[model samples]
Target: MVGVLAAAVAVLAVVTGLNLVLLFAVIRKLRTTEARLGTAPVATLPKQGSEIGSFLIAAEDDSMISDASIGDGMTVACVMPGCAPCKTQIAAFRERPRSAPEKTVFFVFGGQGEPETEELVTSLAGLGQVAVTQTAGAVGVALDDVTSFPTLLRTEGGRIAAVGRTWEDIGAVAVATVR
Candidate 1:
C-alpha cells in the first residue's frame, strides 16, 4: 500500500511538471503574438464626422431601412451571433432609456442557417429594426471599421457623430439626448 501511494505521488509530480512546462510555453507564445500584433486593428471603422457607408436592411414589417432613412441622429448597434459582449450591448440598449425607436438600428450580423441569429433578432424586437445579414453588410464595405462586434455608432445628417466598442466611449446618458 505504501509503495502504491508513493507511485501515485510520483506520477502526480510528473504530471504537474508537464503542466507547468506547457503553461510556460503557452505564455511565451502569447507574449510573442502580442508583440507582433502591436495595436493594429484587423479592419478600420469609419471615422467620426465622415459620411457613413450606405446600407439597406429590410425590417420585419417589410419596410426598408437604410442610412438615409434613419430620422435625424441615428444610433446603430452592430452585433454578431458569436460575440459574448454583444449580449451586454443589447441589454444596455434595452435597459437604458433610448432616444427614439425610429432613429435606432441594430445590425445582427450572421449568415443564413446560423442558429443564434433568430435569438438575436428576436431579442431586438421592439427595441429597433433588426437586420440579420452576412459578411458585415454594406456598412462594413463603407465604414471598414466595424470589425469589432457590438460597435455602437451615433450618426446625424448621414455622418457619424460618435462611435465606440462600449457605451461609455460614446456616452450612454449624454448620447441618449441629441447632440
Candidate 2:
C-alpha cells in the first residue's frame, strides 16, 4: 500500500510539472503576439495639429480619401468587422446627429468580399463614406498609429485636431471642430 501511494504521488508531480511547462510556453507565445500587434501607447496618438500622411483608400473605383477631398475637416473611424468594440462604435456613430453624416468616414479593416463587410458598408453609407482595406497599410490605421479598435480621429485644415477611443470623444471633437 505504501509503494502504491508513492507511485501516485510521483505521477501527480510529473503531471503538475508538465502543466507548468505548457503554461509557460503559452504565456511566452502570447507575449510575442502582443508585441507584434504594435498597439499604440496609451492616449498618445494623432499628435494634435500634425499633418496626416497619405494612404490609399480601398474602393471599387479609382478614388482616394485624402486631405484634398476633405477641405474643411472630417471625422474618421477605424473599425474591424469581427470586433465587438467596433460594432458598438459603429452603432454609436450611426446615432450621431443628422448634420454629422457628411463629415464622417469609416475605415473598415479587412477585404470587401465578406457579407459582414457588405453589411457594414451599407449601414455606414447612411452615415458617411466607407473605405475598406486590410489592417496592414490601412490609411487610417497608419496615419493615426492605431493599435486597437474603435479609434476615431478628427481633422481640421488637413491636420489632426483630436483623437479618441469612444463615441464621447468623437462628439467632443466634432463640436470643438465646428467652433
Candidate 3:
C-alpha cells in the first residue's frame, strides 16, 4: 500500500509539470501568431442595414451603462484590449469622424493585465470621443461568445444588421447593411 501511494504521487507531479509546459507553449504560439498577422487600418465604414438598436455595456467606473443606444442612423464600434487585431480595429475606428453618425465603444474584455487595460483606455481617449465600459464577471465572457474580440457588430434602429471577424469586414458589412 505504501509503494502504491508513493508511485501515485510521483505520477501526479509529472503530469502537473507537463501541463504547465504545454500551457506555456500554447501561450507563446498565440503571441507569435498575433505578431505575425498584424492588420492595417481600413478606410471608410463597412456596410450596414436599418436595424440599429441599444446594446447595454457595463461601465467600469460608474454603475450606469456608458453607451447602449445607437439610434436609427448611428453606428457602434465595440473593441477589446490586448488583442492585436482589436488594436488595429481601434486605430481604424479612431480615424472615423465623430459626427460621421458612427459611435465607437471600448470595452475591457478578457485579455492582458490590468496595466494594459489602463493603457488601452488612455490610448483610446486620445483617439477621439468614445464610450469606455468595464464589464464584470462572466457577462463579458458570455458576450464574447456571441461577439468575440476583433469583432464588429453593426446595429441600426435597434437590431443587429451585420457582424464580422475583423473590423474592416464588419464595418464594410455594416455600412452596406445600413443603407
Candidate 4:
C-alpha cells in the first residue's frame, strides 16, 4: 500500500509540473502579443463630417477605394479571423437590411492564407464587397485612423458621418445621415 501511494504522488507531481510549464508558456505568449499590439492610447474616433483617407481594395484585380461599387454612401466594417467578437459582428452585419449590401465594404484583416478567411470572404461576397488585407493597422490608416476590430464606419459624400460598433448603430446613422 505504501509503494502504491508513493507512485500516485510521483504521478501527481509530474502532472503538476507539466501544467505549470504550460501555464507559463501561455502567459509568455500573451505578453508577447500584447507588446506587439502596442500601448497607444485610443484616440477620439472620427464622427460626422470627418474626411477619411482612401484605402485600396485588395481584390483579384486590385481596385482603388474610390472605384468600389458602393452607391450614395458606404459602410466599412473592419474584421479579423479567429476573433470571437468579430464573428458576432459578422452575424450582425449579415442580418442588416437587404439594401445594406450595396453600400457595405468588409475589410478582412489577417485573412491571408487561412481557409477560414476564404470561407468568410466567400460568404460575405454575396452580401457586399470584401477586401482581404494583411493587417488592421493598414486599413485603419486609410480609413480615418481606426485601430480596433469590429469597427463600423458610415460615410456619405466621401466623408465619415458616423462610427459604430454594431449593426443597429450603423443603421440608425444611415437613416439620420441621408443626403
Go through the candidates in order and give each one's C-alpha lDDT: 0.74, 0.69, 0.53, 0.67
Supply the global lDDT for candidate 3: 0.53
Per-model TM-score on C-alpha atoms: 0.68, 0.63, 0.48, 0.61
* Candidate 4 pairs with clashing backbones: none
- Indicate whether candidate 1 or candidate 3 has the larger TM-score: 1
State in Å the error of residue 157, model 2.
2.1
Model 1: which residue pairs collide? 44-144, 44-145, 45-145
Clashes of each: 3, 0, 24, 0
Local accuracy of candidate 4 as per-residue lDDT tens digits, 1-179:
99999999999999999999999999999899889977765635546566666555665235545433433467778777776877887775555432355567787776577898877677676556677877645567766666567777777766777777776666633222232
Please give, for residues 6-100, the per-residue lDDT of candidate 1 as tens digits: 99999999999999999999999989998999866474555787777677778765788876775456778888887889898778777774546
lDDT of 4: 0.67
Which candidate achieves the best TM-score against the true structure?
Answer: 1
After the best TM-score superposition of candidate 2, give how far the Cα of residue 116 lies from its true spot, in angstroms: 2.7
* Candidate 3's TM-score: 0.48
Clashing pairs in 2: none
Backbone clashes, candidate 1: 3
Candidate 3, residue 88: the lDDT equals 75
